[model samples]
Target: MTLRTSAVQESWGPTAVWSCAHAQGEHVKFFVLGSVGVSHGGPVLTGGPPQQQATLAVLVLRAGHVVPLHELTAAVWGESAPGSAVMILRTYVWRLRKLLEGGEPGKTGAQILESANDGYRLAVPRGSVDAVRAEELAAKATRAHAAGELEVCAEALAEAGSLWRGEPLAGVPGPFAESQRSRLAELRLHLLEERLGVDLLRGRHERAVPELTALIREEPLRERPYGLLMRALFAAGRQGDALAVFGRAREVLADELGLDPGPDLRLLHARILSGDPALLPAAASPAPGRGGGLPAPLPAAPSGSAPTSPAAHGAATAGGPARGGAPAGLDGFPAASAG
Candidate 1:
């Protein structure tokens, strides 16, 4: 049977399982928000074997899309795939379907895990997947922040941040898992930076200092965090510390990369030096609903346009992934092909 894949946009509510109920009103829930794993009802499901788990991870990473056989094999076994790779993969798919469809023994229908033309697709309802829900919340956070509804933005980001239980796809070994883990980690960092921006904009400069300091130390060469630190310090009336931050950033950039600070950092440094009143954090905007409330659902990119990747927002740093390549040791996989 041919099952066509489509984008599922519904938000995840408190009931975090798929709408597909079984004999007892329970359902299988597949989670990929943090660790690549699955649980049915209350207890975590197990006994699929490592290779099978790796196969499931590959499919879950691109849930709702058909990942072709060759691509699956490439992700799972890389260049060293055994001659029986295809057969082995098929067996893995069968096992996963059984695990997911365990409610009905010997069921022939493709309800959750459906077979596509040349690949497989896990057909869970919208928001059932934690990663998808987190993405939606992050999108909402972006929208709320743009509208200057700092509280709403913070709320949304907090919810999004809570979804991550640990490193994504943890313990699932493969090039695909490695790359996805890096991508998800970078996305989380971007979300954290966004929330930090909201904090600074809402005049929580002092409160943001500790977090920004930690981020800067963790990613010393990341210009955006350094810039944010400078702004936060200046807003906190520690102008000397702010300037010292700029000086240290300059030295680090020059010594490590044979480069200088980017224009944004340079401009902030100049503003701090000049005591620009604009450098001081503005008074917090009124809460949402009191002449507030950012519009629901952020604006979409123009037709046929791709939203910018997180990497494009900043310069490549010393220990981070380089431009346009699956993080070091993490081989890239093709985007999910339409089922």
Candidate 2:
């Protein structure tokens, strides 16, 4: 229940193994059950060569799924990877396992770094990594926002944002992680925009101005942020300053993306021009905390609809075209159902 410690029970063969992740202050333990209940305590990792740590961190960050071996190699070596890349990767995994398990190299570590058909997978529990927790919080925040729980949305958004200690998978780079990090950054900005919208709706415009101003600097091309900035400025009784923000956003968007403002933004600009306050929705006012966390359960399998798992989709891949035949970056997105 507490983020620091989790209770895990596993049924194996004819035996059930239960282990508790007990944390003593800053100390951490990873418990597992297979042949027997094993506890990995006393510094899951220690300081070492930067590259080795980066490699292990990347794997840990993406635990519970395979990371393409080629992707992990590229992440560590960039373009200068030697011809014995696979051998070197094996060595790194060997060393990292020794460090993590605090036991003989081949046995404890081999179980963790599982050999999948495509590459390798680190089978750690969810919430074991901060990255997983942050992703979950962001998903929850997104759901709360969509459900019209503005105050709860803001709190969850802030909690999700607070989880990022720095750049995601910091000091690690690979095509998959790069794409994932970009998506997370975009999600963060969207969440921030929603949070600011909630604050502005609550007439906390004065308090929101500085944050919105800083956000505009970071996301100059994002129209929603600019709109919020304008609203904040206007509400703070600085009409001229607010209009100036809109003008700057217009110039930046035209110069950069070579496109006109979107409909929502153009409408906001027009309202600002005509001094028509009716364009602002009355629902902008922040409702006091309906709750402070993730949203309720999403609608389940709409009536009699059958749900598909990722493993099933991966199995379906065998009947589909070869992997490289499709466009890149489309694998993760769900396909449109023909039916």
Candidate 3:
């Protein structure tokens, strides 16, 4: 390999030795998953007040994109921002810049954070933020699941789940952080469900049952987990238990929310009652015209959401919590009226 290096290329940090991340100079890795912090090739620096962390969280989320002051103010203080909110925000930015640089006055000039015309931008290196990495992995899982590459999908989702440290954006104070925290947490749940689905496909239904049951307990109203649990139980030869789960889901929805199970669950119940052979794992992902005419699989994931299905059992959602609506039927089968 001939050497054709330029002065500007050298200024962009050591690119050739990426295997060591910071093989030469100090590099930064911003994290938004669990707690908001940065790793400067050593111990993570998580020393900041809640509001400061909130500011960093917002910029970290929209990394590489400019965030205007007005938007930042709204995220940081919602509708109760004090008159000096802007000044305080600026101070937070300065403190964050110093903290990332180890507080050295003349640290090498590699400013990851920049202020442009009317907003600030965070330019952390790609794959440096766990949240962003999770999203990317989720996308990979989604694609694999869609293409019937169950093992690959499971691996990607598993890797994505491992990146989360704790409660996302933990201890960060701001509307933006709160919203993002909820979003990231839900993404993890969806990925978990997807992984479970892959396990079910691989004839590991016994293992999926307990996990799905626990997920249902935590999110009783989420119909997706309920459906997956039923599938696992039914696959493990607990047909009666599978139907009982449907009954429990119906009861919970009726008692707590004054709502019946969505069409997705209702249809799944009907199919299970009919003993649809397509529900069998061996028949999953069968050719479109074969498999006894089972319904089509889930649709592609929506933009800006988790790259996987919103719900494991239906076209309910692959990104976040399923909102109340006209949902499609269960995976691998068509819709049918509840029995």
Lowest-sum lDDT 10-residue window in model 1? 330-339
Best by TM-score: 3
lDDT of 1 by residue, 127-206 (tens): 44566556667667656655657688787776666667677766776666666666666666655665676676667889
* Residue 285 C-alpha lDDT in model 3: 30
Q: Candidate 1 regions off by >4 Å?
A: 1-27, 46-48, 102-110, 283-339
TM-score for candidate 1, residues paired by index: 0.73
Write one digit per residue (lDDT tens) for candidate 3, span 1-339: 112333322211222111124222225666666677776544457839999998888777676778899989998899999999999998988888778674222453235677877878876544556666666777787677668677887887787776677787888887777667666776677667667766766678899998888888887877777888888887777879999999999899888888888777787788788777666666443555664755334454333334422111121222322434523221332211111
Residue 89, candidate 3: alpha-carbon lDDT:
92
The residue pairs in collision within model 1 are: none
Ordered from best to worst TM-score, the candidate numbers read 3, 1, 2
Local distance difference test, each candidate: 0.61, 0.51, 0.65
Q: Which parts of model 3 are misplaced by more than 4 Å?
A: 1-26, 102-110, 283-339
What are the candidates' C-alpha RMSDs? 9.6, 12.0, 8.6
The number of clashing residue pairs in model 2 is 1
